[model samples]
Structures are given as C-alpha cells and as structure tokens.
Target: MSSAYNHARPPAGAASLPAPDDPVAARLQESARRMAGIAVFSGVVNVLMLSGSLYMLQVYDRVIPSRNVATLIGLSLMVLCAYLLQGYFDALRSRMLCRVATLFDAGLQEHIHTALATLPLRGAKPMLMQQPLRDLDQIRAFMSGMGPTAFLDMPWIPIFLIALFLFHPLIGFTALAGTVAIIAMTLLSERLSRGAAKTAMDLSAQRQVLADTTQRNAEVIRALGMLDRFTARWSRANERYLRENIRASDVSANLGSGAKVLRYVLQSGMLGLGAWLVVADKASGGVMIASSIMMGRALAPVEVALGTWKQLVAARQGIKRLREICKATAPPAAPPVELPRPSRELSVQNLSVVAPGMERPIVSNVSFALSAGMGLALLGASASGKTSLSKALVGIWQAASGVVRLDGGALDQWRNADLGRYIGYLPQDVALFDGTVAENICRFDETATSDAILKAARVAGVHDMILRLPDGYATRIGAGGMSLSAGQRQRVGLARAVFGDPFLVVLDEPNANLDTEGEQALTRAIQALRAAGSIVIVISHRPSALAALDMALVLYEGKAIAFGRRDEVFARVSNASRQIAERQAAAAPAVARRAAAFEGAAS
Candidate 1:
C-alpha cells in the first residue's frame, strides 16, 4: 500500500486548460477570413442573379411582343432559374457564416479556461467577472447568428451602394442620404446597447454569487431548516436576471425598429422620384424597373447593417473583459534550474510565513531538517501554526521569508505538477469527491492500476475495511466523505497522499478524530513509511502518537521553543507541563462543586 501511495501519477492526456500560446486567436481570425471570402462570393452571385432577373423583365416588356407564348415561356424559365440559384447561394453563405461563429465560441471558451487556471488565489474574485458559465448560452446564441450576419453585411453594402449610383445619380444621392441618417440612429442604438450589456454582465455575476452560496451551504440550509431564506435569495437573483434580460431585449428591438424605418423611408423616396421621371418621359420602363430592383437589393444590406449594431456592442464588452484577464500577470513560471530528482530529504531555513491579510505572522523564523528513513512530530496547542508550516513544505503556501528545499532545489523552482510529485499532504479536514475508495485514492493519479490502488489502501490501513464493503475498493463514497466515518476519511486522505510514493509526507492531526484502534492503525502506516526510507512529518497532540517520531519540535504561541529527539524535547518541556497541570488540578475541585450544585438543583 505504501508502494502504491508513493508511485502513482495522473493519467497522461488528462484534460487541462490550454496554454497561453494556444492557437485560439489565429483560429478565430482564420475562420473570420474564410467566412469573409464566402461572403464576397455570395455577393457577386447575388448581383449576377438580380441582373439576370431584371434582364428577363425587360425582355417581357420590349422583346416578348405582348405575351407571345414562346418568348414569355422562355423569359419565365430564365427568371425561375435565377431565383433557384439565388436560394442556393444564400444557403451556402449562411452555413459558412455559422461555421465561423462556432469557431469563435470555441476559441473564447478555450482562452477563458486557460486564464482562470493561471490566476493566483489573490485574483480569484475579480477573474470571475469574465467567465461566468451563466452567460455562456446567451453569448453563444448571439455569436452564432450575429457574427456571420455582421460580416456578410460588409461586402453586400458596398456592392449595392455602387450599383445604385450607376443606375441613376439622383437615386444614388437619396440612398447615401438615408445611409447617413441610419448611421446616426445606429450610433444612438450603440450607446443604449452598451449600457444594457454592462448591466447584463453585472447581473450575470450576481447570479453566480447566488449559485455559489447555495452550493456551499446546501447542508447548512437543510440542517438549520433555512429553506425560506434560501428560497428568498434565489427569487431575488432570478428577478434581477430577468430584469436585465428584458432591458437588453428592449434595447435591441428599438435599434432594429429605428433602422428599418430609415430603410423604408429611403426606398419610398427613391421609388417616388423614379416614377415622376418615368411619367415626365425622362425615364424608360427598363430604367424604372432597374431603379426599383436596385433599391430593393440595396435596402436588404442596409437593414442587415443596422441590426449588427447590438451584436457589436455585446461582443465588444466580452472581448474587453477577456483582455483584462489575459493581460493580468500570471504566477511566475517555474525556474529552469533543476533540483536533483526528489529524495526523502526535507529542509527548511529560517522559514516564516505571514498569511495574506493577517497581522502577526502565523509561523516565525524556524529551521529544521530531516533525512531519509526518519520521522518528525510537531507538538503544540490549538492554533499553534502546525497546519501553516505543513502547507509551506508542500508548496501550497509560499513563505514570507526563508526557503523550503526538497533534496536541494528551492520549492518555488519546481513546476506546479512536479511539486505534487515530490511531496504529499493529508490536511486535518479531509475533502473527498463523490466516488469509490479507489477513485479517491487515484484522484490526483488517474493512471494508477488496481494493484497500485490496493497497495496504497493496505499501507494506509484501510484495505481490510474496504474489502468488507459491497464493492470493495469500488464502494462509492458520498460527497466530502459524508458516507464514511471521520477516521475512514482520514485514512483515505492519507492513502491518497502516499499513493504516489512521494518523498516527503506531511500530515496535520492524523489522530485527531480517530478512535484508539484507528490511531494505532495510522501509527503503523507512518512507521512503515519511515522504515522504507521516506520522511514523515506529523502534527499531533496525542503523546502516544508522538512517541514514534525520531525527532520532535515543541511550539509555544507561534515559535518553536524547543527541538531535539522525541525524549529530549519532552524532557525540556516536562517541568512546564507539570506546572500547568498542577494549576489546573488545584482549580478542578471548586469547579466540580459548582457543577454538582447546579446538577442537584436541576434534579
């Protein structure tokens, strides 16, 4: 079991966030470029099809000679063919645009995941503003339709505008005037939408807060019978989200309606002016037909252009939020200097840690070292910096001053993944996922085999207990080990810590909640690790548990007052313990008499 604990590694190919240099941006740009190319093609095809339809209409007026059967049939057939081709072109362009949109969504998600993983603990709260999963569906829906539609408008607008000018100079002037008016209206819409997007983003973050609260306090809410309070919070969150969504929708509708009105005004004006000229014999039937078709074609792109305004506003906000996170400095990368592959040697020099937002340091200037095949015990009262020091050794918490080196390399120099490979920790409170015993043991090590898992379970002294379960090692544990006894959870946590055969092991109060038999089992597991040339450091208040350690450090307040072999440290602190015990004993009788009087009156 010790062998398995000390040697397992997570399976290769486990999913992780993409690196900083991942090709997401390049991929997004490429997809946009491809969609743009397709748009250009479709625009050219639409222009040709429209021109062909106009030519057929002219033939019916001038060359068909009052519905001559054969000529009329031929012209109708040509118009039908043009209509079919236009439909095909529109479908193809739509598909290509949708593909670009999907690529953008994928890239954005990839970048978000990577950024979240790199942020230090201090930056966790602010970073949540960018990637809340609650906004994911709305963002994706907006992207898929708006992304391609926005890009398609770019090509068609220019082509239609130039074609309108070529048809008649006056009509061209009227279209340009309408374009100016639409631009002004769109700018107003943009301002409105931007404000709405910001509000929506804020509301989305608030919704996440409610989700986290509900999840973290699920047990407390049920235990304390606070269902009404939880329900009230949830209702408030729902109302806020709905209100923001309504505002965004209202803004979008206003923008669309305003732009449509401008397009209709321009279309009507052009058609009216063209009809006056045709009646005054200043325009031909063909010229009027061409002018009307040009206006219809031109109006389509303008309407699409105006609708893209809201999309631009929302995407702008998303991109801005993403940039803020990506540009924030990440944790310093591990240095290149290689430490000797870790061995069962742990050392600390003048180690001191001032926890973030704390006044006095939790751990003071302290120094200690342990070699292979040895064990050290930390003995202290409650809140004596035991867990703080243990955390520093495993690189979970960085020290404010001094260094912790495994083998010979500084802890900070090791990669995050490689650091876990060298040291293991079993915290005082064990946290487990909802999985089988084997699954929990292999949580950090997905590739561990059955033999490796059993080996860890046996060494941690949980092998026999697991085998009695219906599924043995596969027995499913409830969340946070709710299904297991406290001692069982501790054993499983220890088994996981040892699973990779880590060179250094740190346990915080391993015997805290364990019964007498359970403590004995844990003691044996520590002994086995020490005998196998592994260094084991344990924090405990139990004297019997401390007796197995080769060395001991006695702490008072936050300082290590004495350190030596187990017997030597105990000898140094023996008088102090006796003095405190005698003082407590002298007060015990009076306290007991008061308690007895109170009990008698209650009876």
Candidate 2:
C-alpha cells in the first residue's frame, strides 16, 4: 500500500492481453504474447539452419563436378550471409526472452512480497512456503537458455523431414522413423523421471526448512548438546533428496545417451540407403550427404531437449507452484477503504482466538475498552492468553468470534498501511533486521527523519546506549540483531514500537530482557504515551511493569478473570490468593489431628 503503488499501471503492451480476474493468468497471457514475437525470430533462425545442408549439396552436385570456381565462391558467400543472419536472429531471440523475464519479475515481485508478509497471519510456516522469487529465477534462467530454444526448434522437425524426402523417399522414411523413436524416448524420460524429480524438490524444501530453523536457534542447539541429533536428522533428509535427484538424473542421462546413439545410427543408415539408391541409379551421391545432414539437423533439437529435460520439468513445476501461490494470495476484488486516523479508542468485544491446528481457543470471550490518554496492563501466568489477546488487538491474529475496533470501526475496515502508521507493536520475541541502529529504531522507513529516530531512541532510554556503540546510530547489526545482546535488542525494539508517536501502542513482554534502567525507561515511556493521548497496552507477567498503567485485565485459562481499575483487579487477585492460602492452612491442622487420633486408637 505504498503511495507509489496507488496510481501505478501496467505497461502499454500488456493492455492487449486478456485482463482476466486472475492476475497470474493475465501476466502469463502477456508473457506468451511477448514470447510469440521471439517465436517469429526463431522461425527465421530455423530456416537459416537448413543452409548448411543446401550449401553442401550445391558444392558436390554443381560446383565440384563442373569445376566452376565462380559457382563455389558464390555459394560460399550466400552460406556465410545465411549463417550471419541466423546468428543475429538467435541473439535477438535471446534478448527478447531476457526482456520478457525482466518484465515478468517486475509485474509479480510486489504481489509475491505482499503474500509473504501476510501469509504468517494465516498460520503459514515461513520456512515451508515456496519462494516465488527463486522460482521466478528458475523460470527466467530456463527461458534464456537452451531449454526454451529446444521447444522452439521442435516445430521445425517436419520441415527437415520434408527436405530429406526431396533427397529420396527412403532417406526421408529413415529420418521420419528416427524422429518418432527419439520422441518416444523423450516421453519415456519424462515418465521415468518426473516423480523422482518432484520428490527431490520436496525433500530439498524440507531440508532447507530444517537447516533454517536449527540455525536460528543455534545457541539452544549448542548449549543443549543437540547438534549431533540435528546433524543426523539433516543427514537423513539430505540423503533422501540426493537419492531422488540421482534417480531423476540417471533417467535423463540414459535417455540423452540413447537419443545420441539413435541419431548417429539413423544418420549412418540414411547414408547407406542413399549409397544403395545411387548404385541402383535412383539417387545421386550429393543427395546422400544432403539427406544425412538434414536428418541430423532434425534430430539435434530432440537431443538438446532430452539433455535439458530436467531443467524443463523443474521450470514447469516452479511455474505451477508460483501460479497457485499467486491465486491463493490474490488481493481482494475491492480495496479496503482508507479511514481517517483514529483517536486511539480501543475496544474488544467477546474476542476469541484459536491457534493454528488447535481445537481450543487460546483466548476466549475477552472484552475490554480503553480511551485515549489511558493505558491497560494485561497480566497473566504462562499460557494464560495475554499474548494472544495482544495479537488480536493489533490485527496480527484474526479473532474467531468477535471484533477489535479502533474509533468505532472494526480493525479490518482500515487499510493495513494506513492503520499501521498509527499502531505500534512489540512482540514477545524482539527481532531486529540487519541494519544500523537508527534504521531499526525508525522501523527501517527510508523517509524517516533523523530527528524522529533520535526522539524515539530518547523515549526508550536507549539514546545514550546507542551513542556508546562503535559508530553510534550508524553501527551495523547482524542478522536478527546478533551483534547486540538480548537487552540491547529489546530496547531497540521498544524504541521502534513507540516511534512516530503512534496512536495505539501494544508491548508484549517488553521488560522480559530489560535491566532495571530499561524497565524504568519503559514505565516512563508508557506514562509519556498516555499523557500524549495515545492508548498504550502492556502485556507482562511482572507486576513492576504494570505500575504506570491505569487499568488491568487478568486472564486465566483463556478467560478474563478480572478487569477494571489497576488497583481493583490487583486487590481482587490478592484477596483470592489469600483466601485459598488460609483454607489450605486450616485443612492442614485438621488432617494432622485426625492422623494422631487414628494412631492412638490403633495403639
């Protein structure tokens, strides 16, 4: 939803293609039209491909026998010109295909990025999701390589066969039979290898996912002595992938070899047949060579196709997956309306959320309302639904039963980009991208001013700490902030959450990794946000982090146990705990007295 995208339109040539409801179909149609232009050049190139055979025939039948130097020279010049034209056409075709690839990427890159960003909300595993960009690269590489050229040359096979018939019917028949046999072999290769190739791709994806997951938690794996176990699991997966890849490659290689041998035999057979015809006064020696040459030309594409079958199959599969992903994540028919900025009145009515693949709701029947200049603390034990409710409020997780609204409008009613500008969220796990400290504090917005970034850093009380880094705001962080300690990363994320003075701020476990100084800064930031008429919601298990909040909500077993003024909810929880403890103390004495009486009676 960037402003630059708001008024963007497709290129003029794309207008001729059918603009179907499916964007993927439309893109493919446009691409095909562009490829059609390249196909025209391919036709010219293939025609020129026959020049070599014709030149040989001219030299043997006319120039050599007549001993005409002028005729030979003329033929040589014409053949040279033909070869040059063929090269030009081939180069043009390659250029056109590259252009098409560039255009295809330009058309789909944004959609793919949007899908990747939104998929996690729908419970997608980031590692398991197919990478459209990589798939796009596969398609482009195939288009610009021999794979597509083989397909383009396939249609010219019959033309070569006709030329062979012109030489002699027997030679033509031999070539035709060779063509059929090669075609059959190509089909066999596809049949034998497709299943294994697909399995290889799937296993490769799984291996990549495992590798990524383990690397992301390298500390835990190393500390717990899980490296050997992980390595064995990875080795097994890699072996399976390798096995499938070898199976597919073996099938393709055998077919390719068979095709080569068949072509050689067929060419030699045509020559022998032509020789017999010449002896029988049915054909000429010049025609024999010409027929063999034409026959070989016809089979060359088949050989190339067989050799590149694996790439072709893989590209086809990649395209299919990309299409499916595009369809699944297509934008809505009508864009959501962009509403005016909210005044930070947050409300949740009977909200419920069930985690992916779980039958029970993680957060159920939770309700709350907070106005501008007010703050709410979400207090709960582990697995008590505090983080789930926080996610629901921020529109990161959809509620199953009810609604979360800002300024009387449901969260879904607002365009994500517009709504995001006024909302800030700090998740339980603080992940900062690899960039400068200022970039992370400013949420990596290119247009953010230095003043805005410094202000947020000050608000989060990390300004002095950042200044102490090697290069201050310009210091580079490693992937996931590996260059910084946990406390530093948490502080930076806190600054990001409050950056831009958002109207609604939600921080989940913000103090989990913070020291005393960081904790105090967080309390002051909450108070400052509330004073600025921003509604702040903090989710924490530590009571110290809740001191500055105006109200509190206690969640127990996915249900709201209490919600009201902060002191009131705290008092209720404290009283409940006191009553339970007293009852336990009274029952302990009675049980001890009973045990004593029973022992005395027995004695």
Candidate 3:
C-alpha cells in the first residue's frame, strides 16, 4: 500500500520530456489569448478614464473655456466609452475563464481514467489514483478564485510596463521596481505553497487508506461497536487537511496584502514626485495625472500574475506526469510479418520468463502442447508463478527466452487486437464497471446487443438471476458490481469472456466463488467449447475439478513438479486431496470464529 502512493520518480532525465497536448496546456493557451484581448481593452478603458478627468480639469482651468452644451456632450460620450470598454473586457474575461476551467476538469478526468486503464499489473499495490482526483478538485477551486487574470494576463504585465516606460521613463522605471517587489512577494508565496502541495498529496493518500480500512473492516468495526473510533480517525485526517490549508492561505494572504500595499505606496510616491515636476513646469498637469493612472494600471497585471503563481508549479507537475505516461513503453509492437490464423493447437518451446526487474526466471525450460478440443488445468499455490505462466501464454507478459507459437507462427507476429478478438480471458479478480447488468454481461462491447447478451448469460447460467432483479438486464450495478453476490458476479464475468465466440478461452480460478450448480454450469460450458473445437485452459487447485480436463500440470515453488494426463498426475498426487482436506479441517474453526466476529461487528 505504501509503495502504491510512493510516487515513483521517473528514471533520471525521463522527466524532461516536452509537454503533451493536455487540457491544462489548452486552457492556458486559450486564457492567454483572451487575456491579450482584454488587456488591450483594459488599456483603452484606462486611457479614456485618464483623458476624461483631464478634459474636465482643463475646462475648470479655462484652458478649453467652460462650455455648457459642448462640454456636457463630450463628457457624456467619454463616460459611455469607458463603461462600454470596461464591461466588454470584464464579460469577455469571465467567459474565457469559465471555458478554461471546464477544459481543465475534462482533461484531468480523462487522464485519470486513461492512467487507470494503462497502469501495469503490480500485485498488492493499494491504488492511489483516488488521490489525484481529489487534488484536481482543489486545483479547480483555486483556478475559479483566481480567474483569467492570474494566468492569461500574466504575459502582458511586462509588455504593459514597457508601454508605460515609453510614455514616460520615470513612471515606467518606478513601475518596474514595483514589479520586482511583487515578484519577490510571489516567490515567497510559492515557497510556502510547496509545503501545502506536499501536505495535500499526503492527506489525499491517507484519506484513501482510511476509507479502505473502514470498508475492509466494516464488519469488524461494527461488531466491536467502534464506529466512534473510526469517525475520530476521519476527523483527525480532516483537521490535518484544514491546518495545512490555513497555513497555505495565510502565506498567500500576506503576500497579496503586501503587494497591494507596496503598489499603493509606489503610486503615491510617484504622485508626490510628479507634483514637484508639475510645479517646476518640467511636466504638465495632464501628463502627471496620466502617469498616475498608468502607474496603477501597470501594477494591476503584476499583482494578478503574482496571484496565479501556484498554478505554474501545478502545471509543471501535471505536464511532467503527462509526459511520463505518453513516453511509457507499450508492449512490443507486432512484427511486420503476418501470423497464421489462430488454430486449436497451441505450443510453447523452451519457455522462460524473467519479469522486468527481478533477476531469476519465473518459469524456465518449460514446454507443452495443447491440441484443439483439449482442456488443461494448472494447479499451484499462490505466488508459485501459475498466473505469470498464464499471462506469458496470452502475451500479456513477455517471455524472456522462448517461442509461444499459435497455429504455426511466432506470437509476436500476431497483432494484439487480433489476438484479443480470438482469445477470451477471465482473471481471478473480476472487474465490473458501474453500468447495467446487460452492459457488464456484454463487457461494454456495443456489438453485443440484447439477444447476444441474453444468449451469453444463458450459457453462463446467470440469465435467471438477472430476471430476478427489478430492472432485469437493465439493473444498475454499483462500482465494481458490488451489488451482485460473488458467485453471480463471477458468472457474469464468465459470460463476458465467452460472449464473443473466441477460438480459445482462459479462466483463472474460475471456480473460486462458484457453488455446486455454478460449477456444473462451468463444466458443461467447457465441454461445449470442446465440442465446438475451441481450446480451454483452467487454473485451479481442486482435484475434483481436474476430472473434466484432458491434461493437468501441478506447480510448486514456480516449478512444474508434475505434468501429464489427468490419470497420470493424479496417480502421482493421490494423497494430495487428503492433505488439502486435512489442512482445511485444521483451518475451519479459526475461519468460522472470524466470520462470527465479522458478522457481530457489522450488526
């Protein structure tokens, strides 16, 4: 579980890849364009405000000669222009910002979903994906508060300052100084935000752990009457999250306050200096007023830029992660040569698999051949490489040294999509989505319509169960299909694997949750597949189940301890059944006690 959230650092230099076409970058770009337009409009609005005030002052001073009709008309037009410019820019910025936010949310959700689908199988890793989703929510909240000004207007701050300098070097230089100070303040805020980001990530992982713990031990917690204890644990997690948030906010608030104060002071000081210049006739009154207004306008973007400072950090992380995913090595590409069409006969020679990191081979010097209409059973204890062997055979896990030949060509010569189309797989842990019963039964393949779905369900012997539900095939299954009992879920999963009429099918621990009737249905289905000349492979430890298999292999400590016809393997392990039964008898009381305890807790 700890390893799952340990944020595996990309190998050295892998993090330097260019940003991909992610939603965040798209939002930033759109925001940039909108901010550019708004900045121009804002500049025009500021110019009008400055011009209007100066015109009224000129009239009072008799420079333009006070005129009731002309002056009122000119002022009315100026007021209208200012209102129009300000309103237009404000509305434009609001709409653009909303669009950016929506894009951000959509992209984040899509990336999370894609990552879940693409992540490699890592045994026993408690999933940390839920944390990223939570962080994205926080990011959305922060983005909404800052508005388009934070990111979009940022690039314009320097340009506006330069424009002010062109208007008057003195005003521009002073604004530049203020800009530097604002940047320093933002840097401080950013440093403080680092702590917040780390804390937020940690809290998110911790929250997941707590949630899983509560779920896994729900029965225990309830039986022990420890709901209050669990609640306290959750309350503590929330408090820590709150404290970290407050610390981040305190830093940001101080930085904002300081920037605002410094801007005001700089403007006031500029005014005082401009006043001296005006009295000395070195600068005109209009220029002075214009400089004062422009001074503040120049600083406006700087402050907004500072406010969006945290986003830069988050964006960098997001892009780096996106790059890592894009650059992930996919399963080796298929060879240019085409493979023979899949046939009933499958064979492997000198097979050896050494997974990416580990030193030793998981399965070595293994060889076997299965003919059409034949079924083989694999019996092994957990961690004995039985699953790995199955994966290697299906090309999910590559063999380091060997040939996996289906029909008469190398497995690598066959396209993955084509192979998948002809092969059906049922992993030990059945994964179902939050969809209707029919959808799950069809495995979300649109081609499997009502008739096809019902047919598959009938074959798996779960059709009657579906009819028992109020909504029948349309009944909504909760996440992971928790709504269905274990046996029912397994049957549904089996129905899915067998739905597409594949040439070959693989079932991993298919009988794990099946009752006597369910087991019989599976046996009958396997026999039917054999009759259709389709090969079937089953992985399990039940001796009773081996009677249906044409051949069997017994594995121990990652080695094939025995292999042959069912009679031959049984002759070698005739005592194996008695040994298994005795072991179960010894463990029964403890399991029964735990079950009782769990039920009591839940009640």
Candidate 4:
C-alpha cells in the first residue's frame, strides 16, 4: 500500500483504542508483528547491500597497490556469501507478504460474495458491484510486485546515508541533497496527478457498470433498435475516463523522467567531487568510485518508490474501500442462536418494508399468517408491491418496522444458513447456473441424493419434461450452457425451490413465463406442497396458478385492499373494481357536459 496514504489507519495513538470489531479489519491489523519481522529482514539485506561498494574500495586501494591476490580472493568470497544471504532473506520476506495477501483474500471472499449477492435485494448500489473482488486482486498484485519491497526497504535508507557520511562530510551532504530532490519530485507528481487518478478510477467503474447493464439487456436493446443509443453512452463514458487516465499518466511520466535524469546527474556530480578530494590528498581514488556506487545504492529504494507510487496509491485506496465495505456489511459477531427448522406456521405481523436507500415503505402495515398445509396468493397490479412483500416473506428483504416470523421465532433469531434450509424461494426471474439439470434442481448440494432430486421434479410435475431432454436429468443447462426455454427454466426453478420439501415455499409469479401445460404443472406443484403440509406463499397476477390456494391478499398501491379466504377476498376485489368502474361511468356524462359548457362560454 502507499506509504503516503492513510489506508484506513487511525491517527496516532488510535492503535490504543479498543481494536475494531470488524473481523476483516482485525485480520489485517493482527499481522503487525510479522510485518516488523519482515522489516528486520530488510534491515539485514540493506546492510548487506553495501558489500559490493566495500569490495570495490578494497580492490582499488589494497589489492591493486599491494598486488595481494589472496586478499582480493578472500574479500570476493565474503561479498559473495553476503549477496547469497541477502537474496535469501529478501525472497523470504516477499514470500511472507504473498502469504499474508492470500490469507486476507481467503478470509474475505465469502463476505464479499454475500454482500454482492444481497445488494440488489437491499435496493442498494455500491460504487461498483465487483469492486471488492477487484480490490482483492490489487492486493495480490501489490503483494507479489515491487510495491511492498519498496516500503520494506525504505526504513533502511538511513543505513546507506550514514555510510555516505562516513566517506566524507561533503559526499554525505551531496547524497542527502539528492535524496531530498527525489522526495520533492514524488510529492509534486502526487499532488498534480492525484485528482486525475481518482476521477479516472470513478469514470472507469461507471463504464464497467454500464457495460454490465448493456450486456444483460443486449437482446432488448437490439430488438428495440436502441443499440446506437447505448453505444453513444458507452463512448461518452469511455472518452471521459480515457482523458483522465492520459492526464494522470503524463504527470507520472514527466516526474519519473525527472527523477531518473536527476539520479544520473547526482552520480556524476559525486564522482567529480570525489576526484577533487583525491587530487587534494584528502581522500583516495578508491573513495571516489566507491562513494559514487554508494550514492546509487542509497537512492535505489527512493527511485523504486517513485516509479511505483501509482500502484501503491491504488492499493492503498483499495484497502480503504474494502475496509469500509467490511465494516458496513459485516455479519454479526456471533451467529444467532440456531433455531430448529421452521415448520407448522409462517407469520407476518404489521409488516412494512422500505427498500434500502429509500425513505418510504414499499409495502406497509400488512399482516397475515398461515398454518401448515395452507396456501395464500398475493394479488396486485404490476407496481403494487407484491414482489416486495414476497421478498420480505422469504427473508430476502428485511422489514422496515415489523417482524417476519417462522414457527413463532423471528426470522432474525435463527442463523441465516440454518434458516435457509427450511425456506424455499422462486423469484420472478429464474436464473439457472452452469450445471446439470439435476444439480440445479438440488441447489448444487453435493451430497443430495438422486431420489430426492427426482421427488422434487415429480412434485413440480416437470419429471416427464426433464425425461424428454437429450440427457434427461443430466442435461447441462444455463446461460451459455444447454439452452432451456423460459417455461423450462421456470419449471426447473420451481423444482429447485421445493427440493427437500422446505417448510415455507414462496413463489413470486412462478407462472409468469409458463405455457398452459407449464401453468398446469405449477398449479399441481402448489397443491402438492400444500398437501405435504408446507406453507405456500404465492404472488401472481395469473388466476390459473391460484387454483388450490385457499386464502388471498389483494394490494393496491402499498396497502392491502382485501385479505380473507380466497372466495371472500376475490369477491371483495371484484365488487370494489365494479363500483369504481360504475362511478367513473356515471361521472363521464358530467365531465363531458362541464367541458362542453366551458368551451361554449369561452367561444
């Protein structure tokens, strides 16, 4: 990470504050002692780096003048051993850093995935859906690259500077001045490019988001002949991002060239000063050459740091972003007390659901309950919150001000993993994964029995349909996998939802893409689930799929207009609709008469 950036580290003495409860933050901070050990390794390696210059000095001063071949050979062997040890320790330190990055990634992958998967259900949008994953990638790259090495070597730079001082006061001061110049250049580059870099990253993320949106709706766009519009949009975003990226690159390039040119000039200047010293008999010729080499060594890490500042800054930003996500979306410190698999009842009490990032409830003050073997159908207009209520019922979306309960226990009382086993949900859109039909139906449960898969298919009445496929239940079906019709996907999703005969089965528009036969099968599945004592909650506009449900809830806007047994609720809805139509019919004559009178008066 960038040595210059905050990287989510608190201010001085913040380390003494009780450690953050975020497990991800804890995992990252817990590695401090190990990092110190790596720093220690850097110290040894940096000290050993002086071996070559010292060897050159000895060769020029002692071996050359005295013709001592044995002394030269001894010094060469000692320097070689130091070089070998230096390589060993440096490699060891880098390897250690790589492992830390790997461990950090492994610990957070699942949490990142969970957060990504739930964002839509929460009606939320982060800067980018895949950013955390990308952040992890940057961490891995930074760990394996020269970024960490630069930071580790930074602390030992004083060693080289002190050596330069020991050579002579003037030589030491010259090297220090060169180091300051490099630092000044780095600060200037960062100051100039920082805003551009940030803008470029933001614009790039927006481009990715647009690309994902367009890809998902490519068929719609092509069919509606809106491809040109989307292309224009993409071009605009790409152009903006490209411009900022070029700006940032130019700043970095200019500063990098300056640093390199300065380094060579500094080395040459050091040689000139050393020669003057030798001529004055203040230092030897050996001192001149060796001091030049030492000057280069002293500035190696600073140059490396300057060259890689961009990467370090990106990594540092990634760390801060990931830490924020981990903190905001962290799961509870302890898993909830695991409740037994829910059965017998599904309950909603004064339920209200407001989607994340929104002020008002999408569905409000609706209450209902169902006992084992009962079925309820939610009826609503397209935008009347049926889907929101369905999501809340299945625990996909949390209620704004009420509780969804299973078997008298609030849904939050049980661990999500434990609770999920007893809950089955088929959403309006059925997205199958890349797997065999049977595997998808069984939710990819590795230990799922074949008999269980067949049972769910048979219950969903898709058994015969699956057998008609080229490979029957073994057929590989998904996007870019084996092709399945919309009805086939819906049926398969139904089978998946009911697999293992979950206690509460929630289906939102299960028949939305179904044909007559598919709808018939869906009706049979709902009946079967009810007969098997499962509490079935269905939200649908189609009447055929509600053939077996005994209760109904009708919604208009966000409020329930009718709720009762199937017949009573339907009759109430029908009567209310009729009354509204009749009122409008009677008001039509008055509205027309009033309009005509106003027009006549104006004329």
Best by lDDT: 2
Candidate 1 segments whose C-alpha is farther than 4 A from its true place? 1-86, 97-114, 117-120, 126-142, 284-293, 299-302, 305-311, 327-340, 354-366, 379-384, 444-446, 476-486, 541-547, 554-562, 570-603
Per-residue lDDT over 106-206 for candidate 4, one digit per residue giving the tens place of the 0 to 100 score? 65666677667765665556456777777778766776677778878877878888888898999999999999998899888778777776787778788
Candidate numbers, best lDDT first, in rank order: 2, 4, 1, 3
Clash counts for all predictions: 11, 0, 3, 0
Instruction: Write down the TM-score for model 3.
Output: 0.77
Candidate order (TM-score): 2, 4, 1, 3
* lDDT tens readout by residue for model 2, 566-597: 99988999999999999999999999999999
Better of 2 and 3 by lDDT: 2
State each model's C-alpha RMSD to the native.
Answer: 7.2, 3.8, 9.7, 5.2
Q: How well does candidate 4 score on lDDT at residue 546?
A: 90
lDDT of each: 0.72, 0.85, 0.70, 0.84
TM-score for every candidate vs. truth?
Answer: 0.81, 0.92, 0.77, 0.92
| Runs with alpha carbons beyond 4 Å of true place in candidate 4 | 1-20, 68-85, 333-336, 480-482
- lDDT at residue 13 of model 1 (Cα atoms): 62
